[model samples]
Target chain A: MKGWIYQLKSVRKDKFCIMSFFLPVLVAILLNFAGSIDLSSLGELQFVLTAGDLTSETTEWLARYGTVMICQTEEELISEINDPSTNLIGIEKDGKGIKTILSGDEWAILQQAAGTLPLLYEQRESSAQVGVQILSRPDILAGYQHIFAAMTLVVAMFMGCTFNAMNIISEKEEGVVFINEILPMSPKEYLIQKIGIGFVFGCLSALITAAICFRLPFARAAVMLALLVLSAFVSSLIGLFIGRFSNGLMIGVVYIKLVMIVFMAVPMISYLAGVENRILTFLSYLIPSSATLEGIMDLANGGTAMAGKDTVILAVHGIVWFLLYLLLAGRGKKQA
Target chain B: MWNHNKGNRDPARTNHRLTGKSCKTRSIWKSLRSLLQKDFRMMRSGKFFAVALGSLLLYTLFIHFAYVRFMDMEIYQVYLYDPAGTQRNVSPLVHPVASLEEMDRILHKDANSVGIHVTDGKPEVSLYTASKKLDRHRSDYALSLLHPGGKYTPETVGGNNLEQKNRRDITCELLFIEIVAVGFLGIASVLFKEKQMGVMRVHAILPLPKSLFLFSKIFLFLATDLVFAILLVLCNVGLSGTGKILPGLLIQTTILSLVMALTVFGCAMILKDFRQFSLAYLVIALFVTAPVFLSANTSIKMTWIRFHPFYHIYMGLKHAFFGIPVANPLYYLCAAGAVVLLFGIVKTAFCREMEKEG
Candidate 1:
């Protein structure tokens, strides 16, 4: 109880720690604003450069694709095409035929657009009588807003791990470890208090983030909250393990970065890139944070089937890491 | 006071004053050298270089083994279900599906793919709904593949092939992240260690100027980052044509390294402990760097990203990687001015920290 009270006092006094607790809320608001900006038009946007005068008919036809820029000489057109920063498809007319210039780094879709324009112009009509039908998949993940929001929430929850590690290192630096050795409390109890505080803060921060960013029904919200708690427990144990071994801030940070890259970045990137590699998928599921991310994303997309597996993985990780931390703590006590 | 008569004419007194000035200069140089050595030893003990080397190896392996291979995939896959076999000139890239059920299963698995169902010599395109514009592009791409021979082939202009472009692009981004994130935290960790050890306070009573302490660290990290940039280019970008880009790349790395190192130096000096600095680091890394990446790399446009300083720096580095020098004189001026301003702030903070009671 004293330990918890002391931690509460420390966190209350530390303005930065308090700010960190609210950072997710702040980031969620920012993401909300960003989400309003429409990026759909980017797919259709293109820059077309032409040398000399184009027939009015040609200009009108080119305008169907995107913006058309006319340059006085072939030199100007080539210059624009040479600028790797801009993706411009250049057209130059010669006596024999027309030449099309490309920067080579254009997207495959844009390249297809470039190729189809001239052909479609020559045909003067759509060659393939294609009727386009849009199939709606209700099970697909939500827009970038929710994905980014969930990512931010997950990253914010892991802040508990960082804070816990820093807390232990700071205590060691301030000679609190030696002072605690002579106190009545056992090291196991002390370590548990630290990890417990971290777990509690992680849940609180995650709740704030989820509440501000997402509006879900009670059951989904409750499931998400439960998953985040499990994630927090596993992360706190990892933090406890890291803090027990690492002597300095740099090493502690290095360990945290490696953990985050594996547990957070891999799953997020795979999800974003739509990677279907089985080995990568298996590896992602094995990591507790990655599993939690998958669960959170599933819940955000209105699916609950995957949460069961994620909960099992996180619970297993929590137990294994906690036991390892206890073993390390016991050895340290014996050495002292 | 009458002893001034001997001092005015005595060579010994004059020599003593001269020697005193020279001794002070020598001691300052000696102190700076020792400080540099100590920092180097501390970094070595902290395994910073080992970590950096490990990162370099990992990045190299990833670029070669994974990233390049993964990028070879097409933007969108096209599947065709043509029972009538009416499309004689279909692109070889399109996959032929046996039945409508097969197409549905594939579409469910690969949501981004477009399916063309041809019935009675007419093509019908179906896809999972993305954006309206992207959907149009995907459908257009799918239809264009039907008459592959009619597609116009363009003359190639200047630019690296897709493989080289991906390599350099990823290398630049990783290097930027390494400097901005890891290097920033590294300097803070070293400084915080010194602060905890009461070494900064000890420097106050020493005869050397406090600024050397900051300079040694800043220069050490700058040199380390520059070397890392060089090796990263050589390893990932390969030996071919690295010489041309090294100068501009190193210059950009120097500017970024100095700015990050000095900013963190100032923050670490002012902040009371590692926990506060960690929070500060998080804020800077997330809020400051995230937008620069999103605006530069993605289609997400921010009207105000031009005002962001790191945007220009990041673009400059990217251009350097692509063999385009930043011709804007204003950029260099601003970077230099920022560096100078940060140096002043850090110096003041270091002095204030030195004056604090332990």
Candidate 2:
């Protein structure tokens, strides 16, 4: 335990791993905050709908009044009326007869102050069209949050793995391996220290991300940390394997990077299409990013339930991959 | 005097010698052959051959056993609710549920059915709000039931039957899936192999153009993808259907294939390793692929989909499947331009990877 602490302290001194762990979390938080910026100006909607006609027709009309985004369907009327935006909002039709979808306090507000321009909305019905329609803010936000979280996880995995995988190989290049071999500490302890430090860094970064960017609940925070730990460990082992196999540190890192891209990244097609393929569904359960996404999505959407199965699967990934890495690295080290 | 000099000089020999060429044409051919052979061997070893063959079998099995079975379930159920018996022209297949309440119950029960609620006047089509784009469809469906006398036979734009429709949709989806997922990885794997073998750096010292290295990889992936696409279409869509639209489909495939391959190649070279690549991949899959897929396939509509590049690609694939060619030439122009732009970035990244310290 004491040795582990010392190892952790030494590993923290390595700036690359530390930076990789935190950079993605910071970027993700900043980007999410950027997206949260309220940029909906009243002038824009007026220009879009009125097209200079409103300005020309009613000079006294409050052009700066609030706008309502109306859907063409009749059902949209009910939804729009209930919307907070509809309070004190005006309406226009695509072709003719602009029935004010807004009523009550909003209607009174519109009637009292500004002259309303009721434009026609032309409804042309067709039979052969298919489209996607998101129902609410929660749904949209949930999707965006999942995507953002997954991206953050991916960036973190890449950065963490790249450095850790190259750690030993770079030491070998500088003949530090021989120096380390002369020390009282075993090589295994050194490798464990490195992996342990990487994992710790990954955990801290993830917690920070969840707290700052996601604003996750305790359950979600726990889930995210679990996923990050798994990812860190698995990635670190992969790095170890790469370090052992290649002639140079960069080559090993690059090679492992290529493998990760091909085997793990590409097969993850579900994220791209917004629909999970059956084959990929099975694989998603295996990947840390998948867990991160599912967990973070739950967090963002205010879900309280812990994903027990996912946690176990992630733990399994960490363990199995770690063992596989040790075996491969051990073989490569022996051969070298 | 020129003729005499040409005859004495042996024009072919002189031309060859001046070009610093020793059986240059032959060597070029030989080199190309060796390159192809080496690539073929490398590809086979990379497990792509097994993966491709396995994927083909798996997809085929799913299509036949699962997908086809599921698709055969039922067409959209039609409900007729004419209180005054105004819907006499209603087809026998139409469920004649009495009263508006009954019709509403049936629509709610099935949800997939298009209900013709002719309570008072002209028939009003009632279904849960699908989307603004699908509004026209719901209305047209209602109108069609009213005017049963007008045999409005759709004009056959291309020779595509129902089976062909299925084939095209499945083919486009499969191809899209393959390109978006598999081909992207395939390009990365090849680059990684070259990167690992230290041959990427070797290209820098070679007399052959650096662009050729990137071009060669892109060209090969494009050709492989095109061939896979053609086969997938032919096998599933039927020979007759594939024959009619193969040209257009191929055009779409080439564009998607090249674009995806270049994107993946650029990603692989620019990112540090597969871990980083995976992160980038996850981001791409989430932001790019997820949005495009959802916007294109499901009823879940993103108002911002119009701005998404992949959404256009997914739609383009769907359009290709339906045999309705994207009539706008500008779409193709844009697609081509995107491919070129992606290619340029990939090339730059590839060069950078080669130059990076070992």
**How well is each residue in B1-358 modelled by candidate 2, as lDDT tens digits?**
9988767987787887967675776666576666667667777766556566665776677666755444422335677777788667665546877687887777665544677766555566676543332333333444454444322221122233334444555667777877887556656666666666777767777666666666666777888888888778777777866776777778888888888888888777776554455446545655677557655643343577798878777777776665557778888899989998998887777777667743
- lDDT tens digits, residue span A48-81, model 2: 2223323333322223323324345544544433
Worst 10 residues of 2 chain B by lDDT: B150-159
User: CA shift at B166, candidate 2, in angstroms?
Assistant: 6.6
Which residue runs of candidate 2 sit more than 4 Å off their true CA positions? Answer: A1-31, A34-191, A216-336, B1-23, B54-171, B200-215, B234-240, B260-287, B298-313, B334-358
The TM-score measured for candidate 1 stands at: 0.89
Badly placed stretches (over 4 Å) of model 1 are A33-37, A41-45, A50-100, A106-117, A127-129, A138-142, A186-188, A273-279, A327-336, B1-31
| Residues A197-267, model 1: lDDT tens digits | 78888888888888877788988887888888988888777777677777867878888888877876776
What's the DockQ of model 2? 0.05
Superposed by TM-score, candidate 2 places the C-alpha of residue A333 at a distance from the truth, in angstroms, of 13
lDDT of 1 by residue, B163-255 (tens): 787898889989998899877777778788888888888888877777888889898999889989999999999887588898899889999
Q: Give the proportion of true interface contacts each model preserves, from 0 to 1.
A: 0.54, 0.01
What TM-score applies to chain A of candidate 2? Answer: 0.62
Q: Interface root mean square deviation for model 1, in Å? A: 3.3
TM-scores of the candidates in the order shown: 0.89, 0.54
Best-matching candidate per DockQ: 1
